[model samples]
Target: MPLPLAPLIPLAVRLGLVATTTFALTRLVRSATHPGRTDQRAEDALDDLGEGLSLHRPADRAEDRQTNATARVRRVVRFRGKTWELDAGLMARVRLNERKE
Candidate 1:
């Protein structure tokens, strides 16, 4: 007797195959670029953000206090080019005068 195809294959196996193909394509494109052509823009952006903010990993009884303090400090600001706030999400952008519109 032949086995059922859909029931025999697990969902994880299908997802893994898709992921493997994507990784292969990404590597191919990355390798196609010359070594010196590699851009440090992304790295530089990350370093700049790290300089502006610090992450606190709490492990003690004071974690809750620290978290609350940070949360309360959040505020909205309006300025020359645009209006926005420096919060968890904007922290990633870390740009000045940037607005959604």
Candidate 2:
């Protein structure tokens, strides 16, 4: 007697559809929650340019140094009005060194 296989085809298709749907939804939620880095980089660049062009007294060297140091030490991402530190330590050091010219 041949084994019956017709009954499992629909069940397998439904299971595959559910899995694909769940994976897509998870990716959509993840992307919605995390803003892209390009936007953040453009904002930072604009802020720096504005600071450089301002008529007011420039920020003191000490303050600038402190800001640069802290920025290198703690990379953060802003999402949903919340700040999250994303990288530090060795990777931060590597990024800091890349600026040397």
Candidate 3:
């Protein structure tokens, strides 16, 4: 069957736009789900960690330790457009995405 050229041109343009939009959307989702670990802190925090007891640096001062002890142990972090409350284990994972502790 022969199709009209004018209608076909508009249809092809619309399809191209739709394909481009879908491709962009997919890239966004993929990047969020599989975020690259580009920060040094995050890499260091996750480095050479195995079935051994983890070590934490001593507090800078007695006051800092006292304040930290009274503060809440849990922290809230945002990842991939979602909010996550991190305990001990999850905090390590989130720290990998930052440049500082």
lDDT of each: 0.54, 0.54, 0.55
Per-candidate TM-score against the hidden true structure: 0.27, 0.32, 0.30
**What count of clashes does model 3 give?**
1
Residues 5-49 of candidate 1 have per-residue lDDT tens digits of: 887578879899999999999999999987676458845543344
Candidate 2 TM-score, C-alpha based:
0.32
Model 3: per-residue lDDT, tens digit, 1-87? 977698689889999999999999999999889655687785555443343344353465433432211111356899999999764
| Candidate of highest TM-score | 2
CA lDDT, candidate 3, residue 76: 88
Lowest-sum lDDT 10-residue window in model 3: 89-98
Give residue 18's error in model 1 in angstroms. Answer: 0.8
Error of 1 at 45 (Å): 22
Going through the candidates in the order shown, the clash numbers are: 0, 0, 1
